[model samples]
Target chain A: MTVGIVGYGAFVPRRRIKLEEIAKVWGADAPAYKRGLQLFEKSVPGADEDTVTMSVEAARNALARSGGVDPADIGALYIGSESHPYAVKPSGTIVAEAIGAVPALHVADLEFACKAGTESLFIAQALVKAGEVKYAVGIGADTSQGAPGDALEYSAAAGAAAFIFGADEDLILAEIVDTYSWTTDTPDFWRREYMHYPRHGSRFTGEPAYFRHSMNSARGMMDKAGLEPGDFAYAIFHQPNGKFPMRVGKKLGFTNEQLETGWLSPWLGNTYSGASPIGLTAVLDIASPGDLILLTSFGSGAGSDSFVIRVTGRISEVQDLAPKTREQLDENKIYLEYGAYAKLRGKIRMAE
Target chain B: MFSPARAWREYPQRYRLEAAKCTECSKILYPPRLVCPACGGRTFTPEILPREGKVVTFTVIRVPPAGFTEQTPLPLALVELANGVRLMVQIGDVENPETLEIGMPVRLEFRRISWDGEAGVIFYGHKAVRAGS
Candidate 1:
């Protein structure tokens, strides 16, 4: 029983704020942010959009690409996010209901910083492999928050990616060759319950956090699957900033071309949990049959979830069933100034 | 601060766009009513509204209601669906509200409407975005 991706989709908000806009508001040099972080701009959600809404739209696109699979057949659903709208309610339930996958599915909200999204994917895949569920959906989405004047403010953005998994042969878009997760209790970033923004350990988030975990996970997964970096056609890693993924991909022996198609952080900014999954969606939109792709995601705390996937022949049939990821990123953009962005993000105080 | 009542009552309307369609005269009614004004028919079928439509008319609200000030100058429109049912919804994804025309095609998109004060239930609903965008 080989379980694989039946369908996949992504949603990126149309509103953008250039790094210069955010930097000017804070009296910082815009070129520094652009050069250092490799981020030019970031997406901003409207007054009417958030993690839940973005997830719903992405899931609808996923369903559209699923070759008309019945939503009722989805026995499980999970949403991973750092910003779960409500701290108590399950976003998974809202997404499942909106996608017409409700009344008979297991649902939950997961939080593990950025890697929580891939965690849901690993679990849903296990359930399918065990024959516990005929199909399952996993979503990574965030309208991520960054404190004003903080380094995070430049890259934190909004987006979502959804993937549906099943064993049905007719619907398989990519086969999951293997998955590996490396985790440890290394606290590089955290936010208290009442705090509006998270505090990072600065340089600590670099070495021991993202680099160690991601490198170990990628190496471990490749060794476990008896494959190397050259064996894969493409490689995607968690992109917290535009620079980290490229640097890490090089250290892993993957060429620039292998990482190029999925490196969207420079253009779209880091989407936190949505980062790597959205990158994979971009690759899937163009990957050929029999192409092997490696994906690894990192979250502060810290951990990395790595997967070796083989694109199937059916990919071309459904890749265009929904809007392409690049099309959404490139077309019809509405750029906002810093003031409007702050107001839309609720950074400005409102009267009671 | 979350109100279970508000969430429960509007579930069908917000989530599934459930409306009422009079079978006698084939008139589509939103906010599902028991009686159809056209034929005085009490018999109606549960209809789910189409997600795409054409803008019939619109207004730009420069002064938004409280809790909606961030969205000032918002574009609201009356949309006529293919089913011949017309409904009012907010327009989004536009850079300039003034560029909107009466017959511009649009599609429904689910989004966060507002929250109950600072710490309460966040309401979610549909808004219109330009088609193919």
Candidate 2:
């Protein structure tokens, strides 16, 4: 029973705010921020877009590429997001119902900072392998937030990616070769209850949090799968910023070419849980049969989840089934000025 | 602000664009009427309408009602689905109202239609975006 991704899709909001737009409002140096983060622009969800809506779109695309899998046949669904619309209400129920997988499917919302998305993917695939469900949908989505003038504001963006896992060999687009996770109670980033935005440890988030966990998880995955950096065609690390993914991938003995395909943070900013998962979708768009891909996602608590996937012959058949991730990122963009971006993000306070 | 009950009752149409096709006359009724308007048919089968369509007519609402002020100048359209069923929907992802024109190809997408408030249920429904987007 080979359990793997039967279908995959991604959704990125069309609205974007460039670093200069945000910097002009804050009276900061846009060039400095761009040079440091290597991020020029980031996505902004509309007034109506959120984790749930984006999840539904991405899941629908996944189903489209799934070769006619009925929505009702999905036995379980999980949505992982740090910014669930409601704290008490489960995001999974709404997503499940919207995708037409209600009543019979087990659903839950998982949270582990940025890695929440991959966490859903990991559990979804495991359930299929255990024969607990014929198929499961795992989604990572976020309309992530940063304080108005905080450094995170420039990069905390909105996006989502969904993957359907099943044991059906004929439907598998990418077989999951191996997986590994590394976790520790490092408070590199956090937001308390009722807090509107998150706080990070700045420099501390680098070496100790993102790099340590991502490096360990990638190495552990390689060790478990008996493969090396050279064995994979592409490697995607948790992209907190444009610089981190490339820097970390190189540190792990992977070449620039191996990491380039999935390094979307330069143009997309950091979408938190949607970061590496969205990157994976972009890589899958151009990946060839038998191509080996490595993915490592780091969340700020902090932890990292890594997977080694081997693309199957069905990859080409489904590559154009839905809107490709890069096409969403590059085309039909609606660039926003700082004021409009603020209104959409609800940064402007209203009279009660 | 819509109550949860009101929102819940319309989930089938709002979330999935579900309709009913009369077994006798083949008339498709959105909101799934209890009885077919044509031929007096009570028995019908569930049908999911095709998501792609063309805008038959449209208008830009410059002064939006409450709960819709954020999307001022909202473009509402009468869309003729691929099945020839015409339904009214809010056009989404429209950066400029002037870009809208009749007979433009469009596709339905899931989006947040509105919400009650900070503590109320958020409504989700389908809205039309430019086709191929």
Candidate 3:
């Protein structure tokens, strides 16, 4: 019961925030905005967007990537997001309904901050292999808003990514060759309730939360699979910022080529829940048969989920649903002023 | 919240229609970051967006979010500009917010999206002004 990606999709917001605005307002010489935080500008969520809409957009693409399979054929649905719209509502259900999946399909949400998407992937792989379901859909999305003048705001972006998994699929982008997990009391990054943003120990999060966990998990998975970094063509990890993953990739001895594959967040921000899987979706867009891709996910618990995917020959004729994901992102966008950023981020007063 | 270095390091938004561009990636980013979302370089340059686009898609909200109940049935739109950037905004002078279409041409304008009454913070967001002469 081998498990692999049968379809894929992505969604990035169509708007942007200018870097100069931050520079001009924060300070001509704001040290942290300029030096420590490595974001120039990030995607500002639109008022209409939330985790649910982005997930819907991505899931639509995943279905298209799967050659427009009938929604009823899917057996499971999962949504991963730290910035879910409601505490009590299951966003997965919203996505399940929007995508028109089987009414009785398995539906649930996974929360692990940034690693939620990657973790969902690992679980989906298992469920498919166990024959618990013939096809499982995993979505990662977020409309994460960082506090004003807070470090989180600059890199926070809105977007989503989706993966449809199944067995008996002729077109396999990658197989779950192996997996590994690692954990520690890494308090590197966390956004507590009653607080709309995340707090990180800065320098500490890098070495501990990101580098240490991502490296260890990748290595453990490689060892378990009897493979090495050299065996894979590319690697995409949870990117809180552009620098963190690069640091970890170097430590794991992955070359610049491997590190170059599908770096989603730098422009998109952490998409929090959507981060890693979105990166993986990007890998599926261009990867070839026999090409191996390595994925590493680190959540602030802190935990990691690593899975290896080897593309198969059936992948060549993929319908390319990633384009719609890219189209929604690449084609059009809105530019929000600081005030709008605040409103969409839910920072301002309401009419009620 | 803007990270100049990040604007340079990542460019998924920048190069691909994200307004802010980095020296290395020819990318654009809005709400620009400290580093680029593309090249992973810590160097970044700035770019403002063109003030025009079209409604690629949109929906009307009779029941607004926490801050928009006063403007119920507001015609909100998601637009794509001639330059190929999409925005979420209110289409001013809309006859029936519910009747808005997916490809109506609209221009960009600055308007109030929300207000911070407690702090006297007036929030501004992108709005889609119906395109005219």
Q: Individual DockQ of the candidates?
A: 0.70, 0.78, 0.03
- Candidate 3 chain A lDDT trough over 10 residues, lowest sum: A321-330
Q: How far off is each candidate at the interface, as Cα RMSD in Å? A: 1.6, 1.2, 12.6
The number of the candidate with the highest TM-score is: 2
Model 2, span B1-133: residue lDDT tens: 7788989999988998889999999999986898788789999898999999999999999988888878777999999999999999999988788889998999999999998768778999999998864
Off by over 4 Å in 2: none
User: Model 1 over residues A304-325: C-alpha lDDT tens digits?
Assistant: 9999999999999998888889
**Candidate 1 TM-score, C-alpha based:** 0.96
The alpha-carbon interface RMSD of model 3 comes to 12.6
Arrange candidates by DockQ, highest first: which order? 2, 1, 3
Cα lDDT of candidate 1 equals 0.89
In candidate 2 chain A, what residue range of length 10 has the lowest lDDT sum? Answer: A343-352
Please provide, for model 2 over A1-352, each residue's C-alpha lDDT reduced to its tens digit, 9 standing for 90 to 100. 7988999999999999899999998899999998999999999999989999999999999999999898899999998899999999899999888888988999999999999999999999999999999999999999999999999998999999999999899999999988999999999999999999898999999999999999999999999999989999999988888989999998889998999999899889888889999999999999999999999999999899999999999999999999999999999899999888888889888755
In CAPRI terms, where does candidate 2 land?
medium
- Judged by whole-model lDDT over C-alpha atoms, candidate 2 comes out at 0.92
Model 3 residue A331 CA deviation in Å:
3.4
As a TM-score, model 2 comes out at: 0.99
Error of 2 at A200 (Å): 1.0
Displacement of residue B111 (Cα, Å) in model 3 is 21
TM-score (chain A only) for the predictions, listed in order: 0.99, 0.99, 0.93
